[model samples]
Target: MVWVRLPVYFYKRNDTFYFSRSIPSDLQHRFNKRKIEVSLRTKSEAKAAKSAAALSDRLERYWDSLRMEMIYSRELGLKVLQDTKPCTTSEYSLSDALALYHRLKGGSKTKLFYDVSNRSIRYLEECLGHDNLTSIEKSDAGRFRDYLFARGMSSSSVKRVFSSVRAIINLAIREQGLVITNVFSGTFIPDDGAKQQRTPIPQDALKRVQMVCQTLDDEPRWLIALISDTGMRLSEACGLLTSDIHVDTVKPYIELIEHPWRRLKTASSSRQLPLVGASLWAAEKIIKEGNSFAFPKYCSEAKCNSNSASAALNKWLKPRVPAGCVIHSFRHSLRDRLRAIECPADIIDAIGGWTTEGVGHKYGDGHTLSVKYRWMEKIAPKVRELRSEETVT
Candidate 1:
């Protein structure tokens, strides 16, 4: 069969052919660039011609649709043309996406996950009237972003809101195989300013705080002491079951696991922590107390109230710690103390439940209690010594 030669927009550079076409001037506003070029990925003229012909036919049909839209826009006002736009509706609404996200991903997730998801969607709906997922335009995203910023939401917080919005919309798109752009995906969120880093508690201040906690020897003090040396997050400590504390074991440690009321932040967060100093003392106290939940005041079978614990703890700690330091500072201080003793980075990451890079890091159960006990022993003696000295003084 003779091949009839049709227009092939093939051009060769560096022995590779590409299909290139210029946008019609009227359609230029709809495109970011003047020309559309796609690599044919072939050096052979026949292959290049075949690919180029197919590409040209596709682009022609697409451009013809655009031309038809413009014709309708001029005849019937832009609003009427927009109202008739095909594929403008989505199978899922923004609220539906949230429901789907929660339904699929909410297992073992705390109330915070649902609360944040709901709040993020509410913020969007408040700004843009709960538009369908597909109907969310780039301009709507921009407007929603501005609305958040106008309400004194920090740039990072604004990004988080957009993140939830994007994830919800994206899940709907993927699960339903919908061909639609997530307008919230790449919207620019301007930085308000440099975020204030949480200052690590000074060694002296930490010792003094531990001393005070020991003197008080109450449930709240136990919470403080538990986190002071263990580097476990406040939520992690607050959510612990009494059984998680293994002081009776040969080498004392806390089995950090996800509870119904609380979830570990990452898979790495689920590891054993060798208790020492204030943390060990606190564990012993907790076991003697004999409650099902370690911090029953904050954690329940229904939910872990880490936020409430944070507020009370931070307030008590405010006058004791330096400006900018909070309960989280103990986690930071633990890292610094470990580093000061020249602890290996991997050991520090293991102790702190911090995520480390590399596939090999994920291979097995991380550092054994005995192995972690050794590294923990090195930095914990100072705080323990302070407890003794303060009691005597």
Candidate 2:
């Protein structure tokens, strides 16, 4: 007599176990593909069996939920449509999807998230009217894209809107177990060309702007001066705590970290920026003020008001800086200045908190603050001196 292990709906491929199952006919319309396959990502038969069992249970529950929804809809006098035709209506509408998306993903997100998502839905309603999630077609998605272009929205902006719409619909589809295609998934967005380019401020214009910031010496000016050299995003600078600025320390750097009110844009965005030139001056001033938040007018316990900061700063900067060069242009200018000094690319990326490519770049604790300070010091010069040199030449 021999004992045999129970068989699981799993097979081995490339020495890894994969779970494969067939969709029931009733639920076949829900998924794009006929068969459901997932990598169990383990070599051990026991682990693969366990994973397959769990996944099978979840799929059965999901299919049962869909069946229940269909049964409930039939009870509500809703007509069941054929597989060839799109559903006339669904339990989830575009508005319902947006609400579900907000409830699930809006936690710890900035105001911009809500603003962008809401604006996208508003545009959809304007172009296509409010429709059920399942009723949205690929043609409708294309029309929405064209509508955005006609409204003078750039390709990048239009794509962002579509991205928000897609996420909203996708969440509703998964959560509600709806059988519907995401029409907004694959729309082609055109290139924005030079329209999207944020021109780097000219060196002369940059010097003059920095000088004016010093003269003004107000809260907004301090923020401008700090960002001009350090290349922090507006929100990142706005959300700083006074404690984040370390002027008296041996290195005199800004320890950029994520706060509840303000999150770093990327993992790379969280870095210790060495204070130099105008940035150091601004840091010293910010610390001397002894406020709880670095830029109290733009930041607080609840949120970092970056939109308000941008509006005010851009209006003030319009006359001071060259056209096409807004507050964000300082970040581009910083990269250019670093390049002029022949700073290493990786070091520059690290200093500016720009994501560096390649797996090797992730290996070690990046270039130390002292190493960054040395490179930044090369660009640290008096605006008056730099301006005078231009005159002499």
After superposing candidate 2 on the true structure, give the runs of residues whose Cα lies further than 4 Å from its correct spot: 1-89, 192-194, 382-393
Off by over 4 Å in 1: 1-92, 382-384, 391-393
Clash pairs, candidate 2, are none
Clashes of each: 0, 0
> Candidate 2, residues 1-393: lDDT per residue as tens digits?
899986568899999887888888877665555776656657888877776776666567767877998999899999766656443233356777888899999987878889989899878865653334554667888899998999998887888899988899888888877878888898888887626679898877877777777777899989998998898899899999999999897778999999998998899999999998888888988999999999999999987899899999999988877779899999999999999989999999999999999999999899999999999988877444543543211
Full-model lDDT, candidate 2: 0.83
Using lDDT as the measure, which candidate wins? 2
Show the lowest summed lDDT stretch of 10 residues, model 2: 384-393
Task: Name the lDDT value of residue 274 in candidate 2.
Answer: 93
Over 340-371, each residue of candidate 1 has an lDDT whose tens digit, in order, gives: 99999999999999999998988877788888
After superposition on all C-alphas, the RMSD of every candidate to the true structure, in Å, is 16.9, 17.7
Instruction: Give the Cα error of residue 309 in candidate 2, in Å.
Output: 1.5
- Model 2 RMSD vs true structure: 17.7
Error of 1 at 176 (Å): 3.0
User: Each candidate: what lDDT?
Assistant: 0.82, 0.83
